[model samples]
Target chain A: MTTTTRGRSDITRLLLTQRIPLLAVLIVVVVVTFFINDAGGYLTASYDFDYMSGSLISAVPLAMLGLAELIVILSGRGGIDLSVGAIVSLSGMIFGFAYGQWGWPLWFAIIATVLFGGLCGAVNGVLVSYIGFPALIATLATFYAFKSIAIVINNQQPISTPPIQELYSLSKSVELPVIGASVPDVPLGIFTFLLPTVVAVWLLLARTAYGRRLYAIGTNDVAARWSGLPVRDTRFKAYVYAGLISGLVAVVTVAQFASARPDAGVSGSGMALPAITIAVLGGVAITGGIGRVAGVVLATLLIVWLNAGILLAFVGNEGSQYQLLALGTVLVFAALLNGLTTRRYGGTV
Target chain B: MTTESLNKNDKTEKNEKSPKRVRVLPAPVTGQEVVLVGVIALLWAGLALSTPAFLTAGSIQPLLVATAPIALIGVGMTIVIITGGIDVSVGGAIMVCSVLTAKTLVGSGVNLGVAVLLSVLTGGVLGLVNGVLIAYGRVHAIIITFGTANLFMFLGLQIFGSGTVNGIPGTLAFFGRGPDGRTLGVPHAFLITVLVTAAAWWYLRHTAGGRHFFAIGGDAQAARLAGVRVQRRVLLAYTTTGLLVGLASCFVIAQGTSTLDQTVGSGKELAVIAAVVIGGTSIMGGRGSVLGTLLGALLVQSVASGVTQLGWRSQLSDLFVGIFIIVAVGADLLRARARRSR
Candidate 1:
């Protein structure tokens, strides 16, 4: 009996210290709770697999931007990019002007928007890595600058020309080719945009020399410098990568809205805040040098499903307000858990 | 020979003591503060030259009233940042306080003192919540505040019920931009801000408790070792910020139309932070001045006013603000480098 109790305690410790397991458990709890509620006729609509799959559309931009934050925050030295939302707003407008009004080829417009986003990120990189500004200050300044430019560039108007409107098909639900009869149809952007980006990011982080350099520098900048790594260059590239991701998210956002609103990325509480929240909730250390792409993806799923359930449980705007409460409560709870885990178990995995 | 040696030793001791005592206090005005004053003056002069109405009483009074809220909140923010913590929830706190206050005023038509007291108390309670979590929980200030910001916003929205609190009485007219809000030639709101800033400046400079904040920010462990009551000091910092946010919300409501909307304090956090940062309050903590924050708020508002007067898009002002932050922080970094080299 004593051995069994000790063994069970050990398993508990593992679940608490390893972020992936903890998040997985929470996701299960959220889904099961909503399912129970739905069965009891508490939900306004069915909390079925189809609804869950449909909700993944929101996860596209959220997960992408969370990954963007993951990259920047992993660069250490108080690294963060508060301007990703601004980049999305600005880059989406560029996409609007190019594809919607200027009548450029879709592929070319996409490339230009991504490049423009990279250029904006490069500005943050130069200020932070080269000129020695704090990542917070550099990005805060850029957040202002990019947001201003996005708003004023087009006289505060959205671009929803015919081509842009036609782009809405990108977000439509599509059945899987081989398993079409068994599973719910997922949003097309999952395959066309989110999946590709996630795979690319995962490959880059897991397989490349640059990825090792980034983690090393983030872990300890002085040690990395002593080891002859290109510390500044690696850090700079992180911001650039984040910008690139934001640019893609902008395209996803524009397509989802079927219009390039100047405030698409920044309306209400703003995209950057939610992205950062997801990153942190995914067990990304705010102090840097610790996080995973898988963690961010799972975090996105958890929030999206949780929010979907919340929407079903309440009426009208009250649902959204309750969503904020849930988000805040969960974040605070997770953060406190992180602190406790660190003290009791020597930090999360 | 023994007498001459003893006299020389006493002279050296006196010289060392005087300089060390002087070093304990920073310069009355730092280099950054001087530069900020100069920049504000130059901008004012330029605006006056470009637009005849820029320096007029009508433009200036409203500008001062607008600056008051940001500057007042910035005073608390300056202290918080000085202690190596930040309170981003002030915007949300402002929303909750203003909405609640506005509701009370609209519902029962309370007197000015009662309304002000209610708002400040509400803010204090919010601040206390932040302080308890941060002080005892041992979490990052930004993370905790970010969470609370969301919670407070939710609370604020719930208070708004049907979207807006319309037909609010002008109970806060004393803090408004109208003639009733002025005492002689100075706006009452601006005067109150100046008075508060002065008091905070004195407290921070002359009191040991104030000096303790800098000690905590510089190194919390070291401060605790030296008997600084680190947790208590940290709690005080955030609570003070809450009270100030409460006061600033009143100023905000006073300056706005009678209707209280959900957007009451949406982005005010960033605006106050910009003012604090521009004022030479280091984001890294341990060094800052409330007086500089006041001036920073003044400068940002002036730029906005100037932009409008020049017929440029109002949004263009944010771009200038971003540039100003870079330039100010860049200059500070350069100064630090020079000092290190020296």
Candidate 2:
């Protein structure tokens, strides 16, 4: 009996502190809850595999931006990027002007847009790492600048030229090649954009010296400097990476919407808030130096599925409003849980 | 020789006493405040020169009225930031308060005092929720407020139910931009903001309680060790911001038309934060000034007005705002560096 109780407590401790495992369990719970609700005839539409697969489309941009935030926040020193949504807006417009108007080749347009995004991020990096501005202030300023420029650049009009409109096929659901008959189709952008970015970020963080240096600097700036790590350069590159990711998100957003909108990323509550929310909910410490790509990916899946279910659970605009509630509740609960876990144990793994 | 020696002894004693007092308090007006005043004056003069209508009462009145809400909330934001905490939920809180207050007025036609009281109380409650979570839960203020911001928006939206609160009575016109909102050429909203800023300025400077806020922000652990009620101070900071947000919502409603749309309080959080930071308040906490925030709000509003008057795209004003924030904060950073080196 004593052994059983100790084993139970250990499992509880593991679930509470290990963010990835906790997220996995929560994701399962969310899906199962929705499935139960559907079986009970509460949902307006069937909450089935196809619906879940289709919902992954929205996760493309969200997961990517979450990863972007993951990189910046992991750099520590109150590192945050409020300008990502704005960067998406601005960079998407640039892509529009390049591909839609100038008729640039598809691959070149994407590369240019991503590089431009990195350039924008470099501005933030200069302000924050080199000039010593707080990340929040620097990004807030850039958010304004980028948003304003995006709107003004195109005179507030969206570009949905024939070529740009053709980009919509990129977001369509496609079946797996070898196992197509057995499973539901998944969004093409998931493979083309989200998966590639995720895998790249994971590899970079897990298998590179630079990633190790980033973690070192974020964990303790002065100590990293004392240890002869290139603190400033590593931190600067983190912002640049975030910017590049935002730029890629911009392209995905453009394809999803079938247009390059001036306000693509900033419409309504803006994308930055949700992305940051996802990152935080994924157990990425706001203090930095602790997070995983897998955690963010799982967190996105949880939110996307939860939101999709909510749409079927409620009628009209209420669904979206409830999504806001769910998001806020989850974030608060996660943050509190983080604090509790820290005190009860050491900190989340 | 005896007189000279006596005078020298007195001078040394005075010098020693003055340095201690100076070290205890920051300068009454910081260098940033001086620069801000000069910038505002310069811009005003430039605008007045370029456009004859820019200095007219028609433009200036609305501008001051517009600045009132941001500046008012900024007073509370100043306090919160001083405590090393931020409440991004002010926008959501504004939504809840204004919507609730608007619905009440539309449904029951309450008097001004009642509407103001209801709004303030609602804001106070929301703020208290944030305070409790942040203080007791020991979570970072940003995360908690971000979460609450969503909850508050949901509440605000639910109260709306369908669309905007149309046909809102003109009971709030006393704080509006109309003839009644002004007294002797000064807009009531702007006047109230000035009074609030002054009171806050005094409270933060002359009182030990105010000083405690600085202590907590500077170093919470150290402050607690010194017997300061760190949690209570943090709670008070958020609650005060809520109360102020409540009042500012009134100003917001008064300044707008009768129809209160869903977008009423959306994004006001960023605007309020921009004003506070521009005013020379440190984002890192432990140091800030309400006076700087007031001036910051004034400067931003002036730029907006000038942009519109100059026939520029309305959105261009945001670019200038972005630039101003960079310049203002950049100047502060440079000054801090200079001080450190010295």
The lDDT leader among the candidates is 2
Over A98-183, each residue of candidate 2 has an lDDT whose tens digit, in order, gives: 99999999999999999999999999999999999999999999998999999999889999999999999999999999999899
What is the DockQ for all candidates, taken in turn?
0.73, 0.74
Reference-based TM-score of each model = 0.97, 0.97
TM-score of candidate 2 restricted to chain B?
A: 0.94
Off by over 4 Å in 2: B1-23
Residues B1-342, candidate 2: write the lDDT tens digits. 112322354566588855543234677998899999999999999999999888889999999999999999999999999989998999999999999999999999999999999999999999999999999999988889999999999999999999999999999998999999999989999999999999999999767788888878787887787778989998999999999889999998998899899998888898899999999999999889999999999999999899889998888888998999999999999999998999
Task: Give me the runs in candidate 1 sitting further than 4 Å from their true place.
Answer: B1-21
The collision pairs in model 2 are none
For model 1, state the Cα shift of residue A14 in Å.
Answer: 1.7
Clashing pairs in 1: none
Local error of candidate 2 at residue A313 (angstroms) = 0.2
- List TM-score (chain A only) for every prediction: 0.99, 0.99
lDDT of 2: 0.93
